[model samples]
Target: MDRKKFLKNGLLGLGTIVALPTAMNSCTKDDSIDATNDNATDGSNSSGSGDCTLSPSETAGPFPIKTPADLVRENIVGDRDGVAMLINITVQDQSEDCAPLAGVYVDLWHCDADGNYSEYGGTGMQSTNYTNVHFLRGRQTTDSNGQVSFISIFPGWYNGRAPHIHIEVLKTNGSSIRVTQIAFPKSICDTVYSTSAYKGTANMLNENDNVFSDSLEDNMADSVTGDTTNGYTLTKTIVV
Candidate 1:
């Protein structure tokens, strides 16, 4: 669909699922954009499946594995100075079959409220100096099936954009390529998305939003219960 028309006609689901090997943004970023990283090894391009039937939902997770929430201390883990947002992810194959892909590492990164990042032990993210700390970001291997979870807060909106987070799925084995940036629901995202800056970039129509126009289900819809009003959840299948 044409850009203008597409924005207006956006996918129109509560969640925006992205296609494989999809990049959520065309807006070049300098924070950190390397498809290749230390945690991943399988760098080939393929859907995340391998005759495997294990799904993340079914797989045991490295963390306590809790539902996503935004309330203070509702779903808490990690250190007091640094709270992690837990993400429950699932991976699937082409046949629409689902399974837990274990030994896989999931990476996450998101801005804190007031729109700032915590660099290491810095005073959260508003400090003038960009510390080398990576708060609200972590990596954990999926258990037997394909389930991995995180403990974190609902990210605030920033610079004319929607409330969302950045993620990457990889073979904890350090080889498979990665998929990043799934979107959240507008209705639930109202508070953050309503912020002044987000409105400037809010998708007047889904089709108009450059990122939403081209995303895969794995990135957008991470779980079977895509209709939940809680925090974010989506699934992706990776192949090595």
Candidate 2:
């Protein structure tokens, strides 16, 4: 979708700042963890049925994480405040009958609770200045089950984009495999945004988002089971 040029032409000089909510000193224990969807099956494929398909390649958006190698940890929430979310991504190989592709590297990044990215802000695209901080960005290697999980806050929405998360898969040699995004269901998003930390609802929806409009439901996490009080768990399997 030529997202780079789109951001350069349409996002610059927007001069609109999304209101930031009060940040809590620390996330509550209940919200930070304890809500796990262990029985939720993988719903990342195009069809809801139990089958694997190659995840569509997507843009990294304008705010790609800087120095991902320096941010290797399971907990990506650094001083950000919102409903805690556990993102579980499973990587599979399409050539090998969608078997678990273990030992690969997964990089995941998303905006903070206030709809502001960590390392790139304080500019026309993002009004909040967070250049000095690194939050909601992390990299982890897949386990034997081809799964990598991150502890982060449920992301807040920006102007024209829906609530989503960016992910990049890399081989053992550090070469890129695919860049894609994870989408949240509208019901889940509405519920999360209604929380006190989120301040309000999103300005856009998944069907209307420029990136996810084109049959991107294949990347949507259908098994997001949890409440706003205890946090949520998003599980998706990406085939590459």
Candidate 3:
């Protein structure tokens, strides 16, 4: 395991892409009087076969399905470049109400169109720059039931908070993980949550971004409207 200790344990093995969407409501309903039943469309199937478990601080592994694209941009600098955010991702292992997980492997990344980080956290190119640089690196695997879609654009506003994307959830046991990251498209350029570094990361996320202030990480709340003069389509899902 030596190659600088296997890339420093494969860039600290990224904790399953920062721990799968921090459960805010992976699949739940009853929003008081309702915000249109939270956009009702339950086709859940992250496939763990329902009854969530192993989600408390699960450390997947020293990651090694593939590593060394400049350490995968120094271990995902918010997954640079290909950052122009236009999305429509989906996945489900099971939340009970409706299951639909089929053929998994859904990994994604972000940072660009000016929010920087196309290769090394920001300001793209390296590894000899040119046969050397590859911005916003990407990977998409999931179909039949679990889904994935991407079209790209609108991902600016950086340096502090608001506009985000970072996800990782693998299958084949190891507690059938649900590591997470998802949130972006904050009402055109009103600059999300306004001022003070996006209201201090949306007020320290209720107290802290602790696994994104859970409720089963709410199946990773995802949304990004269209008509940036026409060009946007991003989608995501994973529960297996």
RMSD of each: 13.5, 12.8, 14.6
For model 3, residues 1-240, the per-residue Cα lDDT tens digits are 122343334334222111112223322232111111111122212222233422222222222223222322223334332212334455654454435565555455544445444434222332222223444444455566566544333444344334445556555332325555554323333332332222222222211233333322333343333333332334444443
Superposed model 3: Cα runs more than 4 Å off: 1-7, 12-37, 40-74, 78-91, 94-103, 112-114, 117-132, 140-161, 166-181, 184-240
Which prediction has more favorable lDDT, 2 or 3?
2
Scored by lDDT, model 1 comes in at: 0.38
Clash pairs (backbone) in predicted model 2? none
- Of candidate 3, the 10-residue stretch with the lowest lDDT total is 31-40
- Give a tens-digit lDDT track for model 1, residues 151-199: 5545554444444565555554555344445555444355434443333
Winner by lDDT: 2
Q: What are the per-residue Cα lDDT tens digits for candidate 2 across 101-170?
A: 9999999999987899999877899988899889999999998889877777889988989888999999
The list of candidate 2 runs beyond 4 A from truth reads: 1-50
State how far residue 134 of model 3 sits from its true place (Å): 2.9
**Deviation in angstroms for 217 in model 3?**
7.6
Cα deviation of 208, candidate 3, in Å: 19
lDDT of each: 0.38, 0.72, 0.37
Worst 10 residues of 2 by lDDT: 16-25
Model 3, position 172, has a per-residue lDDT of 33
**TM-scores of the candidates in the order shown:** 0.49, 0.79, 0.29
